[model samples]
Target: MPPSAREAANEQRRRLHHEADVVVVGAGIFGCAIAFALARQGRSVLLLERWLKEPDRIVGELLQPGGVAALKKLGLGDCLEGIDAIPVTGYSVIYYGQAVGIPYPLNAGADLGSTGGDTKGNGEKPSRPEGRCFHHGRFINQLRQACAREPNITIVETEVTKTITGTHNPQVLGVESTTRNPKTGLREKGYYFAHLTIICDGYASNFRKQYINRKSVVKSRFYALELIDCPMPTPNYGIVILGESAPVLLYQIGTHETRALIDVPENTPTASPAAGGVRAHLRNVVLPSLPKQVQPCVEAALADGKIPRSMPNSWLPPSTQTEPGVVVLGDAMNMRHPLTGGGMTVAFSDVVILSSLLSPERIPQLGDTAAVRRAMKEFHWRRKGLSSIINILAQALYSLFAANDSQLKALQRGCFAYFQKGGNCLDGPVGLLGGIIHQPMVLVYHFFAVALLAIWLVIKEV
Candidate 1:
């Protein structure tokens, strides 16, 4: 064969090796979810991941009621249900060593699953589902399995380096990646062209950073540790133990295991391995702060005096989409503290909105710069406010509990006492977190007003 003919053949082979209508980066929950959602819509999708399965990190183990609803919308309840994820009835905010449980959806954990048990046919859309808690690794594997079964989906275990955009315009055309390099034991560099690119590479997405020059704010306060065994029997309840310093959280997972996070501020000696030590700090500083019964679990878990795991509570700022035809979702866009565990749900919510808005009818017209910007504008506007609110609330709660602020501590106690008097104001934030209250800003304002009045009445009585 002629050298020219051989060269042409090699080029043709390279072109055939890479193809897709959409390319999704990061094969974690969000990436697999995007691939599944797009494939269901009859769009060809290629998903790239550095790992085949999602990491079993101390992240997103709990899904809020809203998150449960998002999974149902994507037909994931049955799969998740099979994994033995427990239903989270509500949340309890332990302030000043006092536990006040706020039941989800007016104290009734409603049935909103797709099995028609919790669903109501409004003739337009289905009702929301109850919150669920599962092992992160198990849940993500199920999602990957679902995506892999689809013919229109291709899951590739690889690393994506750069997002390629048009030279003339700033719209993303596809991505460049390394499949498996012979020298590096990874693959050679390759490219995949697509009409749209969804970046779900998490809070540390290279693609997201390349398009927009933003950095993540790293707060090295408390780290997390998971325990498979404890001294006492397991309970259904999860506790948020507030302290004058960094707060701690303890919860039961499954039958015999429990998870705990000892949140020590960066300035505190609690986080220092040499200052107080992890186990000693938990025993002397944190344990004495909790009830006697809870003390046993902490002691038993730290019996080894060496935690098997730890993770810093890091948060990322809101990401802006600079590359057109490319949009980021999930933690890649915005990340809050895991104390709330709403990250996955928030990402899934973005997927639903983006998928609906970017249907064939919309994508074709997105060719224009203004229209492309407008689509992203809507996406940003839709998510920014909510994320900001959640992040602020989570951070505020963390700071309030972790600090030695007499005023904040008093405020926390008074707020719970107010709720005990059948105050409806606290119900709104609960509803908002559960997906029952869609407009969180309005509801929160109302809550604030009611809280102000209640505080005033208490002051007058004094």
Candidate 2:
């Protein structure tokens, strides 16, 4: 190619620029929800996605009851329909061979009704107090479709390279992107100018470091397996098994398919079918500990010789922000272990709070950095009410279940015993886990109570 022609092409690419009130990067759950909410309020939104097709992944499969309520408030209750999603009533936990059932609080139904109302206008709620779980890809597609239906939202299929910033101030002005044709392999560069840029890219977001200066630490990893024809002892309840090696979670994702997530230490040897690695680990360490009804499905899965999918479990402590005109959210902003299945719940809750703060009545002009910054300040604090509870509970619970020390194991026993008490004791923690409760102090109180119970039990044994 000649230099003159190359220069001409560069000039053409530089001339391409689009504008919107808000530019949202990544079309995952958070991005889609935020775009839908903003568009519904008559704001012009540009939602960008690298892949126009539905996403396939193992995470974000479960939506807590609280998330369901938030979805209804957003008028997205119907997204849960036509997906063959399964209802999750509560949890069935097996600790050291003893088992107990913890149901969602009785007030959950009323709570849903209070906030959700009859979104369908049929005088009935589309969701129940119970949660729902389905294929992650299908759920995300529903959210993307919802955004596509909004008149104010423009969906773009492209890759966002970086944020466009102001000349003097540190405020964000827009985003730069690149588009590629799948058939001809042609690439084009473009820019999107907006008053505010919202980043909802997933856990591995590239824009996160540009906005926040914190690093996510990997605590462990989860190996996922799909078990066909698996039936839980309690059909409606998800199961948490605390065995000797690590904790295992089992829940039905479809009518005939169940998903099992087995926690593996970061240092554990990788599973390989060639060396009989996964088979040996399951047969020797995991299989013997499972309940009788679940053994057959796990055994069949092992015999199939396909290695399970693995995902890193990471934690990022909340951080303060000083940047203006840019808001980083979802897993990109904060993440907790998937053991509690709260990722989607946290994301939805963040959208609910952020959308409310960014409503037209709150900020008349989208480009007003002063107003957006002020609302962001309130958003940062208000989000903690729910995010903190869920974050602490997930970390604390994973510690108890993945007990690596004798002290933690004792606490794990105490935790199970505490649940076996069968009243406020179980309901309190379960409510927090299900996203109904938002009190951090309530979580601290329950945590210490379990510790005291563990100490008491240990002393009695000695």
Candidate 3:
């Protein structure tokens, strides 16, 4: 190829991704999913990412059964394959010293954007829904690969500086981003235009505060460590250990590697460096709290002298999308504690709802700002049935599991005991946690039931 022709080709590539029918910011979980969904709906997309490399993170490792189902619905289920992902069937909760197994409800189908979920039965899906766990980076890479294969989608590596809006109204026109020049191999400023822009820039989003006007509240920070060939008390389940110093989540990400995330709330004295730091917290508080068989592995991993990295566990409720021609999705818009691993489930579910509401059949043209805003309003309300339920339940359970107050402790005991009661008491709560059941009333009913039971237990002890 001649130099002039080569330069011309490079310039053409830049122009190609500079404009599209829809511009998606931040190719994280929601960004990747939505870009693919909209592309499949016959819309050209520019999926922009600040860094176009595989991401290594803690929060997105576990995909609840509901999320997996939604992924399948988007025709991206194959992303779960060949990543050495492990299947998550249920959760084993260990409280102080006692333990209980809360497997997912049998015969429950994935919500799949259906109203209130299929509480009865969907003969098409498996009777028992199964979740999947893997390295967060691997899973995301797979999703990105799938997006690359799509003809309508062009993935661009760029850092979005800010959004560009019309002077007349606050409606966003597109974005001003820093796109690297393919010819010079140096960063250069460029602009991307599209009819609609969706932001899914993970928990720490740059455009969120300016657009959504909601702040993410940090509940706690989860410090993570990787254990090799660690033997757990159970297989095919996410192990939740409460009363063992905050809340600990253990799930296998691969055949031999298990990811252990230990939650350390802010200003914790035990985790303070002066008080021997997080290692002391793990040695004194977390070590003894684990099952005896798993003790050696935690100790060995700690002995490696690897100081764990931490990610904030935050709660950001859904705010209405009033900004015309621009919408915020994923963690940028809302967040919840990772206690039940509901973030991905809620994200995928949101995509299902958003995809349905914004389908070409309904909106027809991506350029219609009015139709887009109306759909977003509908999305804000339509998604509440699942998003609110998951968000509320994740926070509430984190409160109960990590309860410090005496009353909360009592409720925590009752929550565990409620699971022990078996039947709907166990199935209902677990189903909601795994994102299998969509009924909000089920969460309310069980919460009240646990409170009442806690009262009885307290009185009986007194």
Candidate 4:
């Protein structure tokens, strides 16, 4: 049946009011990346951000080599140019007073496992393989600037309140947002209609439940501190110190500053801020376990009496989406423990896959529900190939490093021994950790190999 004249007029008015092909909520890394990618492809995108100022949160400081490559592919490589970001060569894990260095694969480049002949073998020098770490806010500002440079992208400072759903179907037709006046502090509600809506509001997303029916589970929390003038024994390498109540991660985030994160169990009681709780814990328990070189820095930071910032570590497994005209990306859709530092890598890889699937050449009209649905289905399955490895590794490695159980403790010892072996065993796992290797089978093989080694060691000890 044909729509009535009144209904057709209403549809035209809605389309005129919301003159965009896609409405993206949240202007964080994921949202900005998506908006930038779409706009470069000649699609009109409305990017809504709640805060106009730079965010001061602690997470999203590291970007894996794979993420850098994805950024290049998205034409946003310059985002890392002026952020004063530090190059991370590899990781140094200290277990039971012993340390082993696991570096990213020697010849690994932007694209891993591609059939480009080894440049070294071809008489050409290979570039150094490395990742990056920096202040999270600076990186975000870089991305926002990149998004704003595109002519097709519109940046709006507003807080999205809810999704405007269709009366009959489950599809999200648009979004409702509230904008506040900077001078008068008055707020006004507005509606922006679009053919598609993307939710990238990070972990505390409000629109996730409307499309995804699952909730994020808080597995643990991280207490973070900044250590000034604290340089690691090996520069450009991240340090993971085990044997504490949980794992403590230390990495140089700037030339003169290192970021230290201590994992605290979710059920554990935290001290009150007024009573010097976090400082006491660091002084009493965490400091003794850290390397001697950084002890003074930790001591100074504790004595400074600044409360360490706390962030919850949550995990949300991915699910196949059946919702039409809506897509969820970044930490909101799926998350894993940050022990592996693979969150932003996964999010960037997701954007790469999704943008390719919904490229302008493929689906010219964003309103084509059937085509977008098909692309999203493919995106979901194709993304798993890479995301599963990173997600599972983060959880599994955290279990071993945390070593809450007897079996996990054995596994932890075995893992250290495997890294000490220093051949395919070490390179393969580090490659996966660096986000260069996308194969889950390789991860599974190395994981079980470590387990078998652990079993052998336990038997020999007995």
Candidate 5:
């Protein structure tokens, strides 16, 4: 707390200064994508990672086609081809014992045609490749390796301590971090200076608190248990098993690996059961509600999995930016339920948009402060619109399975019945939110008309 102590600390930080064209915090898929994009543009980039090992828990294993297209743009899709992620063609909605699957419509190579100054393909070739679910840890590790192979990029395994700001205004100039040397276990504090500082530092970010102090209110109603080596059916697809008690989602990833998300409602008492102990409870409560064929796989998955901690349905502050010189992307800026599988897609899109705005040619035209601010503004405008839409849809979906009252059940049944006939009141918002369509309200209007028609038909039948 003394002046000398503070000066020494500042001096030490300055001594470790690292200069780059850009400093990206967090080494998840989001950060890697941005770093890869920028490095391709000949920018000297530094990527900082808080942990060397990828966190094993319930996170996005699903990568939507839009995100795949983004990956293809970076020329990293070839790297992913080696990982063997299962391509998903569509999604399924479950309610009241019935399931309805919705396939994604093809994009028709519109963007690719535009690249050559010709609008060909005639809606035949998909603009975006089909989505796939992969093991998050494996996927991230692959991306990290790909970035390491690039000459313009460097990886720093350090925990960010603070963001350096310019005096007159709160403009981020650089980042201060600390990493322990593996040989000596001695902590070495360092500074990374950059023209731009991007925060992709996950949900709990110190820099994020410096700007937007928004906290997540929606707690986890579930925990995930990942398992391997079981006679479980290869869920070549994703499925949500809805039940009266806790709904569990089971799916496959990366060949032999299987990921299971078992809902543990907040209302349920925690007795701290063993890994597979919850399986008995699940059988007694959720399994009977599912199809008979699914029961064996569910039991096998439970038996072979490890019980991870609770999964929070997290969110970010309405505004994720507080400073002028820095921008927050991915979960750092905002997040929705992973079930919708839109996290990395939004983050990757931010990379594309931000890269365009931050190009050396454009930087002179826009100025540093103005350009970064514009990027953040545009990032929010695009992502927040998508986030709000996802939140509404996810909440509605969860409420149906979470409901216990008779009135809620009746409403859910009726809604499910209507949706079965190809009705989606949230379709417009969903389309926009899912990045399938840009204008969200159009899907909303279509959904409303469908709902009205369905209601009228039911009334006529009655």
Candidate 6:
């Protein structure tokens, strides 16, 4: 399937019955964007998905400011529009019934996000850049629509069974899929071929174990409850509620719906069925801690008697990509805890970096396995700047927020205290959390500052 400029021009992209220049195995956040990007570069792309239906999930509802910047890079910024998406200015964290506001940095890394502020410099200084939150399915539908409009891209609704590989060598040829025949309404076996195959099947990918050596670590789950027309202490700001137990997250995904995710660590007796299960815990523990205005909404949401749905909070470090003709990416390759809402931010950033490295100018032929492998190596190291910041912060913060030991509890209190100090003490950490800051040393500096402060407070109390 490798082609020269002349061969590529002569090939009919519409005749994509079996082969193409590239095969993308998921139409998710990463899949659609990558397909559209490669197709625009004159590569025939086959975008495969098990189902074309809009996704329904609480994860990826919040996109950090840095993610918005990367979305614009992919030219899919408009996908955020027409969905009644809320502008996220910052976060509201509540510890032991006391609340603090953590706003995005004024500079916000030269204003990376496209929403919330007029930075046109019309004499007004400009507001801080903003992040966004919305219905995950709505945003995904927009991305799929964008892919459908790309001429060189062919969107197929099929379940990718496995990768098709050459017998002589381990080089991936394409994918074997199960597609429903439109005429018979029965799924039939099919195979699609390409020089390059990208597997971004998301957090629950079936292909991940076959390709990567690392495994995801799961310690807790975020149980979800959608609060309708909920009132918040701070408008358009995400809320984090901390107590002696695990932390809870609340954010407005749309004008009418507020998503509430209450973290429950593994083996916590509060969530044990013998202890009256999760409902009893939410009603007795979480409800009382919420703001007076938001309390009623939780009551109403809980009144319906539907058990809360849960998603695992997992973490997996990055692994190098070395397999020829196949690249495993996105959540499959790496994942972090969802506590910071940084998943989409890292996904878009990876797309921005990987797409550029594999761009036509950089690697003229994707079929050139050696050239593509080199680019993947570059991508692994290049993505570390932001991904490392996010991965470390996510796993570490969760440990602090869900502190079960005295030491971690001390660190949690220090974090809340650090936020109150204002200036860099606040902006530096919040900027990093919002994905606007990338300086690892800045994070290290601030973390130790809090640790020192924690020690001082402990000594004073003693």
Compare the candidates by TM-score and give the number of the best one. 6
Residue pairs with backbone atoms closer than 3 Å in model 4 (clashes): none
lDDT of 5 by residue, 255-285 (tens): 6666667776554543225433554556566
For model 5, the superposed segments whose C-alpha errors exceed 4 Å read 1-17, 94-96, 106-129, 167-169, 227-235, 269-280, 304-309, 317-322, 365-367, 384-388, 423-434, 446-462
lDDT of 1 at 78: 61
For model 1, what is the error of residue 410's alpha carbon versus the real structure, in angstroms, after optimal superposition?
A: 3.1
For residue 69, give model 4's deviation from the true position in Å. 0.8
Q: Alpha-carbon error at 252 in model 5, in Å?
A: 1.9
Give candidate 4 misplaced runs (Cα > 4 Å).
Answer: 1-16, 110-125, 269-277
Candidate with more favorable, higher lDDT: 4 or 6:
6
User: How much is the lDDT of residue 189 in candidate 6?
Assistant: 89
lDDT of 1 at 8: 48
Per-residue alpha-carbon lDDT of candidate 3 for residues 1-462, written as tens digits (9 for 90 to 100): 975564445335436657777899988899999999988887778889999788888778999988888888888899999999998889998887788888888757534342123444556544467899999999989999999887777888889999998899877888998877889989888788888999888888888888887798896899888889998888989999987478999999999999899998888888899999888888888888888878888888888776788899999988887778898889998999998899998899899899999998998887888898898899888888888889999898888788878998999888888989998888898888888788899889998999999999999999
Report how far off residue 176 is in candidate 6 (Å).
0.2
Tens-digit per-residue lDDT, 246-335, candidate 2? 889999998888999888776555344454575577677788888888899988877767667889999987765657778888889899
Question: Which consecutive 10 residues in model 4 have the weakest lDDT in total?
Answer: 109-118
| Per-model CA lDDT versus the true structure | 0.66, 0.83, 0.85, 0.83, 0.65, 0.87
Residue 338 of model 3: what lDDT?
91
Residue pairs in clash, model 1: 111-118, 112-118, 180-186, 180-187, 181-186, 181-187, 245-402
For residues 255-282, what per-residue lDDT tens digits would candidate 4 score against the true structure? 8888999987755444345545666666
The pairs that clash in candidate 6 are none
- The residue ranges of model 3 lying beyond 4 angstroms of the native Cα positions read 1-17, 110-127, 182-185
TM-score, candidate 4, is 0.92
Model 1: which ten-residue window has the lowest total lDDT? 111-120
Error of 4 at 414 (Å): 0.4
Please state the error at residue 21 of candidate 6 in Å. 1.4
Error of 3 at 66 (Å): 0.6
Write the number of the candidate with greater TM-score, choosing between 2 and 6.
6
Better of 1 and 6 by TM-score: 6
lDDT of 6 by residue, 191-213 (tens): 98899999999999899899999
- Model 2: CA > 4 A from native: 1-17, 114-128, 269-279
